[model samples]
Target: MRPLFVIVALSFAPAAYAQEISAVCKYEYTVHDQGQKSGTTGEFSLKATYMLPVGQPLNVQVRTTKAPCYEFLANGDDMQISGTCSRAAQNMKMVYVYKIDRMSGAFEEHFSINDKTGIVHYGHCLPAKPLL
Candidate 1:
C-alpha cells in the first residue's frame, strides 16, 4: 500500500481542523509517472494510514519503505516526516518524504528507491484501519 497520500486528506477534515486536528487518515491516490514524461505504470487503490500521536513518532506502513519516521511540526504552515526503507538483496534504499501545508490544506509525499520514485496527491482524510 502506498502511504503517500495522507498529505491532502483534510478534504474531510473536521470544522475545527484549521486550529487543531487528530485522526488516522487514508487518502485517495493516483499514481503519477516517477520521472518519465509519459504513461503511468498503474494506480494504487490501497493506501496506508498516517498519524502523529502525541509524544510519539509518526507512524505509517508504506509499501516502499519499512522504516519508522518522525514528524516535524512547526506552529505555522508546514510539517514534514521522513525515513528510509531498504532492500537487502539489491542493496538499495528508498527515502520517504511526507509534507503537509496547513495554510492551503495541501498534502504531498514521495519516495525514491531503486532509481524509481513516486508521488501521490491525497484527496481526502477519513478513518481507516489502523496499521498493524
Candidate 2:
C-alpha cells in the first residue's frame, strides 16, 4: 500500500511543479549564414509570452541588429507585429490574434512569419542575455 501511494504522489509532482515565471524583456538577435551565396539579414522587435516554472507570463520586446527590423505587441488575444524586409526590399506589417498559454520555465520556441505562411521560416531562436 505504501509503495503504491508513493508512486502516485510522485507522478503528480511534475504537473504540480509546472509553475509560471513572467518578466518583461528586451533582446537583440542576429541571423547570418556565410555559407549561403545570398542570405537575408534583418531584426525584429517582439512581445512574447512563455511558460516558466516561477511566476507569471513573460513578456518581451526583441529587436534586430538592423534598424526598423521588426516590432511585436500583444494584449491578451491581440498581437501586432511590424518590420522591414531589407533583402526583399519590402516593408511589411501585420496584426493578428494569439492565444496565450501561461505556465512556467524555459521552453524551446519556434518563430514563424504570419503563422508559418511565408517564403522562409526562421527556425530556432535563443533567448538573449542582458549586457553588463
Candidate 3:
C-alpha cells in the first residue's frame, strides 16, 4: 500500500510543476515607422501577448484587427525573453524579432520586410491577468 501511494504522488508531481512554469506576458508598444519612399514618420499604439510554455516554443499574438499569431523558438536567456520568427507574404519575406527585459519590463521589437523595409517598436510589458 505504501509503495502504491508513493508512485501515485510522484506521477502527479511533474504535471503540477509544469503548470506553474508556464507564463503569460502582455505588452503595449508605441510603434514608430518612417515611410521608405515618402520619408514620412508616424506613431501608433500596439498590443501583444506572449505565451511561454515549458519545454516548448513561445507564441506571440499581436492584438491587431487582422494579424496572425506568430510562433517563436527559444533564442537566448540572459535574464530576458527573446524570440524570432519569419514568414513570407505578398512575395516578400518578413522577419520579426523581439526582446523584453525581465527586470525593467523594457520591450523592443524589430520587423523587416525582405531586408529592405523595417520598423522598430519600443515599449514595456507586465504580467497579464488570465482570461476567463
Candidate 4:
C-alpha cells in the first residue's frame, strides 16, 4: 500500500506549482460625482497580475494604483471573470470592481474613491506579453 500511496502523490505533484494570470487592460472612462459627469473623458491602462496557488487566496498586484496591492475577491466561470479589490487609507477608502468576458476581451470597470467620487471604464484586455 505504501507504493500505491507514493504513486498517487506523484500524480498530483504538477498541480502543486503556482499558477499566474496576467493581463494588460485598457479603458476609456468618465469621472462622475453626484450624478453629474465631468466634461473630460480619458483613457488609461493597467496591468494586473495574480499568483494563484491551490488552497490559497490569490495574490494580486495592479499597476497605476496608489496601493501596491488590494484585498481581492474573484467570481469566475468558463465564460467570464469578475472580481473586486478594495483598499483603505487614513480617512479614505477606495474600491474597484471589474468584469471581463473571456472570449471577446470586453470588460467593464468601476472605481470609487470614498463616497463622493467614481469613475466607470469600458474596455478590453489581452494577455500580457513578457517584458523580456
Question: What is the number of backbone collisions in each predicted candidate, taken in the order shown?
Answer: 3, 15, 0, 0
Residue-level lDDT of model 2, residues 64-112, one tens digit each, is 3323334333222112212223222244333222222222111112233
CA lDDT scores, all candidates in order: 0.38, 0.28, 0.47, 0.53
Task: Report residue 23 deviation for candidate 1 (angstroms).
Answer: 3.2
Better of 1 and 2 by lDDT: 1
Evaluated at residue 104, the lDDT of candidate 1 is 38
Give stretches of model 3 more than 4 Å off.
1-66, 76-78
Q: Which scores better on TM-score, 1 or 4?
A: 4
Name the weakest run of 10 consecutive residues (lDDT summed) in model 4.
11-20
The predicted structure with the larger lDDT, 1 or 3, is: 3
TM-score of each: 0.37, 0.24, 0.51, 0.54
Evaluate model 1: give its lDDT: 0.38
For candidate 1, write residues 29-114 as lDDT tens digits.
54565533332232122223344342344353333222333333222222433334333335866555554443233344465566
Instruction: Looking at model 1, report the run of 10 residues with the lowest lDDT sum.
Output: 38-47
TM-score, cand. 2: 0.24
Off by over 4 Å in 4: 1-20, 31-71, 115-117, 130-132
Superposed on all Cα atoms, the candidates' RMSDs to the truth, in angstroms, are 9.0, 12.3, 12.6, 11.8
* Better lDDT candidate (2, 4): 4
